[model samples]
Target: MIGFVILAIIALGGGIGVIVARQPVHSALFLIMNILALAIFYILLSAEFLAAAQVIVYAGAIMVLFLFVVTLLTAGKDDREPKENLAGQRLTAGILAVLVGGGLAVVGVLYPSRAIGLGLPHNFGNLRGMGVTLWGPDFIYLAAVALMLLTAAVGVLVLNRPRRQVKPAPRLEERES
Candidate 1:
């Protein structure tokens, strides 16, 4: 319960950070915080395998890719400013945030300690069971993840590939000489 509270606070803070941050790199870092908080929640729920996978796959690989893209695409600090006007955007976002927050608060009040009643399934946190479940019933998802990672790898490679250079022609007198 205490763990859940901590994780929820961290997740909320990260959510706000991601929204309020201006720099792409800062936003990516905030996203990493959110992923880590979620991983902690999984751990608290007795899903050790899922927690590890979340940290490894999301916090490790995906966030690394995000940072790489931010670094490669932005080039420098000069590119951190907003590309478009933020006029009236804050009001809309604030309204949406309030709606979501109110909905969540209502749900929390209605279903307090709801997860406590969920009995742990057999082999809930067992490594072998998780392995079998992943490789057996969820192989398609695993394959999809592999393909997605492959696509992201290809994207990174393409993005970072050096541009072709074109040499300027010599002046007429130098060419003639």
Candidate 2:
């Protein structure tokens, strides 16, 4: 219960930060907070490996990349201009939120007493077990995921970096004459 409350608070705070912060970098940091909160929730659900992976991937690597981008870009220090075009998108977002909220409300009302399955042993969080699962049988999937992330990171770096121009050497004076 306490874990859930903490997660809820963190998530709410992160959401508020993301919306209220004017700087894109700050907003991205808030998103990192949200991802970390989710990782904690995964830990609470006894998914230690998943929680660690979430932190490493989302909070560490992805957020670092976001910071790199924020640094690389030339967004001004001033607060971002308010968007007049947001009204349409805001309405759509609000409608989607309502639909999701309504679904959750219905589920809570209909199955208030529903229980979830908690699988596995106490030692499931051990590194050995996780390693075995990752390398022993699911190696292909793991390799694929790693490859995808590497490709994406490389692609982003390549796309964002400034390109260099090759300058031609000047001809000798005699040759020109």
Candidate 3:
């Protein structure tokens, strides 16, 4: 229970850091921290396969992909853009964040009685059990996620590809000369 609470705090803090980070790379690092905390939570829940998947898939692959996208977009430049002078944007953002936090606190206080408990089988944490569960009913959702990732990767590649430069035709005088 203590471990769960610690991991939950880490996850929550990392999530907030991800949103609060200014640089994209910093945001990705924060997201990785959140993923690691989630993996730890999975371990605490006796979901070993989920823990491994969370670390391997989300922390490893997805974060790497995000970093790559950020790097490509930034082209290794650290030039920070000038902040927008939108009046009250910061105040509005702060108010919205407080509202969201208060709403979540309210939900946390109120939703416990409505929560349902499900019993897990003995082999639920094993890879074979996870495979069966995933490949059985949730295969379509898995495939959709894969397809979405592939599409995003392709889109990034397309956006980052160098365009062909069409040379202008020489002027008549230059051609004659």
Candidate 4:
């Protein structure tokens, strides 16, 4: 109850931060915070495997990928233009977003779902089930995809790494002085 509320606030706050963040890296970090909060929510919902997957996949792999791309994009950017001209636009967008969100909230509260739940199946969110599925016939495809993505990320990093600027050797005339 209380935990859910706290997690909800955290998730919402993180999501809002992600949207309003000026820097791509900061946005990615805020997204990670939101992802982590959702992972906790999955645990609260008795979906342990989902929680783990949320943290491992989204918070870990995807966030790293996002950071890699952000780093690659911003690495050489030393200067940026002032954003004062967009202040009015930002405020207007914020107000419109709040109004739309509030309207949706009101509609949801006024008309809640009345459908009965079918509930989770046996071992629905258990790790063993997920492990078995991963190790099943399609394991090769999954493994190959994972390998390719990881290799690609590493390759990008290696290719884009900063190289040291080396000075050339002095000529005989300069060395004589």
Please tell me which predicted candidate would have the highest lDDT against the true structure: 4
After superposition, candidate 3 runs with Cα above 4 Å error: 22-25, 62-78, 113-115, 164-177
Tell me which of candidates 1 and 4 scores higher on lDDT: 4
Model 2 segments more than 4 A misplaced? 75-79, 82-88, 105-115, 157-177
Clashes of each: 0, 0, 0, 0
Candidate 2 at 141: error in angstroms? 1.3
Instruction: Work out the TM-score per prediction.
Output: 0.68, 0.64, 0.69, 0.62
Which lDDT values do the candidates have, in the order given?
Answer: 0.86, 0.84, 0.87, 0.87
Candidate 3 per-residue lDDT, tens place, 87-163, comes to 89988998999999989978986786433376677588989987887799899998999999999999999999998
Taking the tens digit of each residue's C-alpha lDDT, what string does model 2 give over 5-80?
A: 7897898789879987878888999999899999898888778888999999989998999888987784665566
Mark the regions of model 4 whose C-alpha exceeds 4 Å error after superposition.
Answer: 76-88, 115-117, 128-177
Instruction: Please give the TM-score that candidate 4 achieves against the real structure.
Output: 0.62
lDDT of 4 by residue, 75-147 (tens): 7686465668455887898899999999998997789666527676667679876677668866998899999
lDDT of 1 by residue, 1-177 (tens): 677778889998998999788788898999999999998888877899889999999999989988999899987657455565568887898999899998999998788886778898778876877878779999999999999999999999999999888776567557643
Better of 2 and 3 by TM-score: 3
Number of the top candidate by TM-score?
A: 3
Pairwise TM-score winner, candidates 1 and 3: 3
